[model samples]
Target: MSPERGRPPRRAVVRAARRGLGYMPGTLLIAAVAGVLGLSLGAGGVPDVVPAGGGLTVNDVTSKAFGQHAPGLPIGELRHFTIGNRLFNTNWVIAPASVRSLDGLGPYFNRVSCSACHVRDGRGRPPAGPEAPMMSMLVRLSVPGPDGTPAAHPIYGEQLSDRAVEGLAPEGRAAMTWEPLAPFVYADGSVVPLRRPRLDFVDMADGPLGPGAMTSARVANAVFGLGLLEAVSEAHVVARADPDDANGDGVSGRVNRVWDHDAQALALGRFGWKANQPTLRQQAAAAMAGDVGVTSEHFAGGNYTAAQTDAAALPNGADDEGVELSRKQLNRLTFYLQTLAVPARRDTHNPVVQRGEQLFGAAGCNACHTPVMQTGATAAHGVLVDQTFAPYTDLLLHDMGPGLADGRPDGLASGREWRTPALWGLGLQKRVSGHTFLLHDGRARNAQEAVLWHGGEARGARDRFARWPAEDRAALLAFLDSL
Candidate 1:
């Protein structure tokens, strides 16, 4: 239910009151008492507080809209959303151990849970305290092949696992640093600095990391509304592809078709910056298996070596084999991701915000970060359609300049290319969420930093932003946050 945008029934109410006033005071009081008693007894229902034919204020519309879609989710389906929240919370701060049964936990991995990096399921900012600057966020790096393609390392390789068994600590610790660059002053006099990210990791003390070792780094992303991204049809994305840059805009869009184990074929990539993983299901499975080292039927073989496998050393019940996640649990996780609602916009009508929106369009930011695509009708979740989604991403890979490049390619994303991330959740970032680490390397500590770090095809826009006036620049940022 969208808001009621029609006229109010004020005249009708006024006439009804006039007639009621003519009734004796005693009779009116008795009638009012009877109405209260009926409501207490759960008669038909409480008359609509909003009242029929009434003009809906913004608050009324929002409260009602929220109740219809979220706050008052229909029964039965509530489990899907609620269970999704639980799984999210579980994965948020606590990692699933590689070898866990009903008894307990595992062999090898990185941090315990998703929240370790993402923190409050929001954005991750810069490294502070004792944590190394590289510790601002973890990047997953795999070595490149002779052809320059990213491939898993042969042995004593793959992603660096920092946690291992009882006696042995995990091998491979990545240490990184940040070097800030000069602030670029925009046309409007707004200035923002850029950040350069550098990485170095140590291999196992007892062993040697082979030549084919592959590396990739991941800055944690908020898991809000990912399901919508996943649900967006391949046809819609492929149609947006301007592979040859035929539009003459120099911005060519392409889909990252990747291996899909569930579908048992190649499918459109939607999740990662590379679009490397096909679905939320595959992404979650890999995260569980690779990041936390928890093996499941989805990733049966696991991404580690015998020397690297933790169960043998740590001594936990073997969840990798018999105790795997059920389809229900997996689906719940996906559902929660899909339904994680975008936060309500603040001050969308502010003049600054309106101007910023217009400037955003003029700035060509919308060329790639295209906005407003209506979700098609669906039986299970009607909320997908007509639901204003502000994911300011075309979900296609783009050649960001050298400044933003991590030099580690994955599937379809070249070292210079990455899938556009959604910008809708910025309003709550590092607030209800935490950290403002933007971009793949987590080097850009804030929005301005991220913008300043843009390069390659975005260089022109970056330059433009560098010269934007302070007030206009504030409007631009305001526009971004209003997403």
Candidate 2:
């Protein structure tokens, strides 16, 4: 399919919103919530507080908020966490180096280490423009496959690696140019400028990205609270799959069934922008192979296409098991991700944030971004089991419409679908990663832009948000920041 095939027109979106397509009134939604929870939205009462990560929540608001380990962890566990942290930040060199473990750097890869992209364990931002290099972002490429699956491009493989090891040339560099979309206008006559990214592949090592190639550029997301998300039982997540929208809420969410290397079977995908990886361990291992070109047990062998002989023939710093990353090392890295703490919500008592909380429910943002979920008893770590947490997501896939579409499919997710990202620790994005770029490709510049870019199943909530008065919108954003 053409990249622009399914994209809805800007004017059509506005007219549909005006026509009340999937739009829910604020009063009716609030009344429904009040009826179900038996809770008052009255002026005198404050909603009870729920820990953002259950026992794993931290109380830091500073720059290090996203980097903290879960509090009250045992000393032995902390030791493993420290080692994993070191490995995550380690910069790998070329193969045959003195340090055997840290050697086997990419013949073709995006960054030097995990920290290079996910700076401080927080979100990553796209380059300022075509002039700047993509330091913290990467591009995915594929051609149409036989059975609706994505096949890796013959020369560049699944990902574009702009940087290569010393001797060989890099695959290619991706430059982004922003095309301005029509400014979104509120009911009160306020206008917000919006832009979408246009990607161009330049300075190719082998050859051009031939015809029929589909590409999707994505910025790295935050790495915290993933273990908690993984612990949410598959049954619990599957129960929320209203694929047919049987309730007639105009919102249908379903799970992505993806390959699990460990289990050797299809499992619920709960990580990545499209929910493509089933577990944090597989997610980490895939990142090692794709982003850093380090081989692991989960993904063995060099990250090279058969066409790139030099890259494929490089000497690897593989251990006895024939992979650059050992099983023990992978275990430590997975443990690090599994035990990272989620930052607690701040400024809950502020009246603006409080008002925003009510508007959030009124706008039906809580339907997909479910405020609460409970982890089951099967987590490997005791701290992650049977805990109620407020991560602000249902861990399900939803069709976000063509406005935010990449026209790239993965696993069971279509071009129009994306996993609802957790909104926890959103406000501190700038302090931690130095920018507020949101969405899969960093197209949305802030939380408000992120909301306005919503469509498909979220059109109702997005339109309801746009129709609100300025004060109500501010309160809703303030409530989001509080998370």
Candidate 3:
């Protein structure tokens, strides 16, 4: 809640908080301060037993954009380069042209190049350069379990993938049609339509999608500050789960746990809808398999049929199906993803942008799309704590309405759940090679359409947005672009 929301004034909230913590022993006081700010004093910085909220306020939170970086990781100098050269021309090796070709592109692949999906290791939009929306991206799907529970992944033949490594096995295609609702009119008269996608995946005639034939529609989300977000302690995440909606806010925030088959244990999901993958290593490696049809240590084999896996054209890595992923490649991709920095926030001075930020909080967007958070330490990445980050997402999945459901379950995430995407790095849209295709499934032509599609738990917030004035509406869009 904002400091101004309570009946009490700013000073009163601060004062009451101070008195409430007055009895905390010195050790607890020091720990409390460290938990929130995580900053050190000068060279001799020792724990200050001072009361919390000495002068913190909304404005005070304005400059808090620098989140903690994983300590040991190198902060490479991001010297600029052309989009093709920096993102497309080379492979994950960062060598001159190590991984440039599509040699292992698929037994059921979406695109030929990593850059094909992720425009500049940045954001990708709909109709990415006039490509069909389905080619723009494909999601995973599966059928329900015997007990009628949602299935995260296809238990049998793959859920959805169009291309193949050797033209040897079952491949599926995804098609989408839009149903537009009535236009939304602001008090000042700007209109926007609320559209949802009814996706159809077909042509998997070679086999049946197993246990649960569910689908997860995904497009490349902005990759920024992944390492820092990874380093956040599980304790901090559990601290926020409100699955039962005990607060009566109509929003039930749930945490999803995933099975890291590679790690061989259940892990708290930190990526994908329902937090399906536990860490960047797992997510990146699996992408090597699903997105590129390349076998990795984690995925071990291509998403090919038994016959396709035996095809001579299969890559060196897939000789033995279901083998382990390449640990070396996993590390490299994880390194690249983790090192990607969050773009600086833009447009803070515009009145509309400022109002949007205010409304974002007022409408409870911040509760899920939290403006900031800190990271903790990890041996692989040190000094992750104390630094501040502005991811604009809590990395938790929320219950979006049926309009957005893909009917694919993974781990703890139901078909209707999706992770809150981070809004940082959004302003660079115009710089990439493609058009501004926003929203999952590339359905919303732009940011405005994206906002209007909100429903389910977000219905209240979307309704509030629908009733907003034109200037206020513009403010919200401005705030979103500022990310």
Candidate 4:
């Protein structure tokens, strides 16, 4: 698969120009002139930014946009991708059943399948009200360990599983109620409503969670273009680390070193809310074990804690190799994630969007949301290797201040720290997921609110954005919408 396989064709650009040449920026006009003269725009600093995912990009602006396979997937790997898609959407049942392949659901789990949380392979949101259950979200549980690191709650383990298989009691039900904060008034007198989530546990099957147990509520993140992210070199990630702010940029991003289960050693953290998981494969295995209660090669045992004897003693759906999901199945699932396409950016030539892009860079948002990163030569797939993709994240941990802090440490990430999420799909979230809820906890209602919630290292950028003219703010949002 060539790196240019899915780029927007010349005709697509012509169509965009024809829609309204009046709305085109001068830079875009220059590009049009360059195109007519058979001149390349690369030398003039006019970026060819339409293909957001490099060769893996797909042009689709509909609800099904996030679920596409990466452009130019090999015929041989297509079978594995199809099988992985099935496994992701398949709902496992209770153990010792006829369909052994789809068994071993849970003694305790949050959702039955990966698609249950990440519906359509897009983002998940919190429940609309307290009357609703957490359909596409979950709550993590832990307490202070002897060395002050986070340890699993003696009974609840690492995650709170709200659902269980037949004849077994679930850990508990996770609920949330929103507390409306004072509306943020911008310099231009525009106000954006803000709300914070208040997580509560009810219907505890065992006993009360003792005092000082920490909990974090998280919505399921979109899973597309992960293969490209996984292919980004550790050296590239480490080169961006500025843990001490030695350059005085006020943006001190630090790598979160975590245990790589496959390597059995500490490695550069890349995926997850806290950048806690080292690889996409490990992240998939962990989700299967923690969210679906399905054991994989990485997590061969059930998710039950020693204290949960009833859950542990129950008949599991382990196969001949003593694991619910075999190595081949896990590999297929990982490959599926590795090949999911990233939607191409929209409205790249729109004048407002161009201004917003400029404003985004001017406000230093790019400091954390680095627009482009080159993948290493080696990847799970040939298409993902040596590609320049725009994921818009540093994948480093930064202190987000007290307002957004869960007060729950994850690996080397402190309670105030959170991994910077990619901004590539920010524009199409509403079309794909039906909701605009964002952030690790889904407290922010939209991108603007999400920006307002930023603190700590990002406070400078947030403050700059807060002080922008309303039109500039709108343009910035427009640019994000075009992403």
- TM-score per prediction, in order, is 0.77, 0.92, 0.74, 0.91
- What residue runs in model 1 are displaced by over 4 Å at the alpha carbon? 1-72, 91-105, 129-136, 146-148, 186-191, 203-214, 306-323, 378-382, 385-388
Model 2 ranges off by over 4 Å: 1-45
**How far is 75's C-alpha from truth in model 2 (Å)?**
1.0
lDDT of 1 by residue, 286-354 (tens): 776666655556866544666554444444333435434445666776665555555555666555554
User: Over the stretch 1-483, how does candidate 3's per-residue lDDT look in tens digits?
Assistant: 111111334464344334434546534653543444333432323332211111111111121222112224334412211221233323332112333332344556666556566655655554323225454466666566577765434332434667654545536566666667788676767666666566565565446454335566677765546766787788878787788889988777788898777679887898754577888878876776777666666676556545443443444433233332345445655656655445455555544454455556555676677666666555234334445566666777788898777656677877788777766655545444244556667676667776677777778888887775554555567667766
Go through the candidates in order and give each one's C-alpha lDDT.
0.58, 0.86, 0.57, 0.85
How much is the lDDT of residue 249 in candidate 1? 76
Decide which is better by TM-score, 2 or 3: 2
lDDT of each residue in 351-379, candidate 2, tens digit only:
66656676677788988998888899889
List candidate 4 stretches off by more than 4 Å.
1-45
Better of 1 and 2 by TM-score: 2
Give per-residue CA lDDT, model 4, range 1-483, as digits (tens).
011113344565344334434445656655653353233467555545636788999999999888999878889888989999999999988888899988988878889999999999999999877778999998889999999899999989999998888788888887799999999998778788999988778999888888989999899999998889899999999999999999999999999999998999999999889998999899999999999999988898899998988988899999998999888889989999999999999888776666567667767898888888789889878999998878889899999899999999999999999999999888889999988889998998888899999999999999998987665676678778888
Name the 10 consecutive residues with the lowest summed lDDT in model 2.
Answer: 1-10
